[model samples]
Target: MKLFLYVLSLVGFLAGCGGGGVDSIADGDPSYVKVRESLREASSRVLDGLRIRGSYQAEDVFHVSGCESDSKEGGGKLWEAAHFWQIDEVNSGEVQSSIDRLRDSLEAQGWTIVDFARPPQVKNTVVRAQDPKAGYVVRVIGVQEKSRVAVRVSAPCFRASGDS
Candidate 1:
């Protein structure tokens, strides 16, 4: 009888821990939510003027410094978009022109043009469409210092049938 009671108590304790454990729910971090909202807002602005065949998907990740130390540490993912382009016969100048057009459009909306590269990297997500059937992805990172808001924009390159 004593052994049975001991076993029951152990089981109950384990069950309770599992139900109310720290890992059960997220930390409810406000920073993450803030970053996400900011990304959504920025992405909407960036995509305002563009020829996209479909909708855009923007994902953002935020990192904060000084959380563990004296200095502030932070990182984030802004936005991503998919586009289709012809790869067989596109020239560099044409691609540049397209990018320039997009850049100008974005800038007109008050987005700061940080850097433009042929093949975008962590710092840049813009890609030149080289294949007719192939598509390019674009990503942009920007921040609204006032609200500590950041955004990354990415989209695929879509070329008209006769355009490319």
Candidate 2:
């Protein structure tokens, strides 16, 4: 009986580690599917016109605000969905133009450009945007050394504490 109980407890703990068994849309959960789809759509806009050279990754994550009272008891917590698309290689000369186009598109869609940095001061060109109403942010990092560009879009978090 003791061994049986121990094995059961172990299984339960492992399951919880995988997000309470609500891993992804492929898990057949309708709500998860919707959230994943929405995040993908938002992220795709950021990668528009970019040639994908490497792998793409997307997932749901719990963001910790460092206000967690017990850290385990959940003092501060937010749930988010995000996606990233990485480009194979960036053309050295076209970095500026690419950033310009991305900035224009994001601005046209009502996203506010928070920060944009170019070469000389920084080796990589970076663009960050935020949507106040939607509560999401997007970042585009152009790595000159790696000759790659990565576009990431993160959804507005759902606070666990119910605080706005």
Candidate 1 lDDT, 75-161, residue by residue in tens: 322222221111112232343344556567765644555556643344322522211222222343221122111223322211112
lDDT of 2 by residue, 1-164 (tens): 22332333234323332233232222233443454456556655665634333423222232212222223445434345455445545666565667778888888888899999888888788899997778678888887777667666666654332222
Residue 144 of model 2 has an lDDT of 71
* Cα lDDT listed for each candidate: 0.31, 0.55
lDDT of 2 at 101: 82
**Residue 158 deviation, candidate 1, in Å?**
35
Which number leads on TM-score? 2
TM-score of decoy 2: 0.62
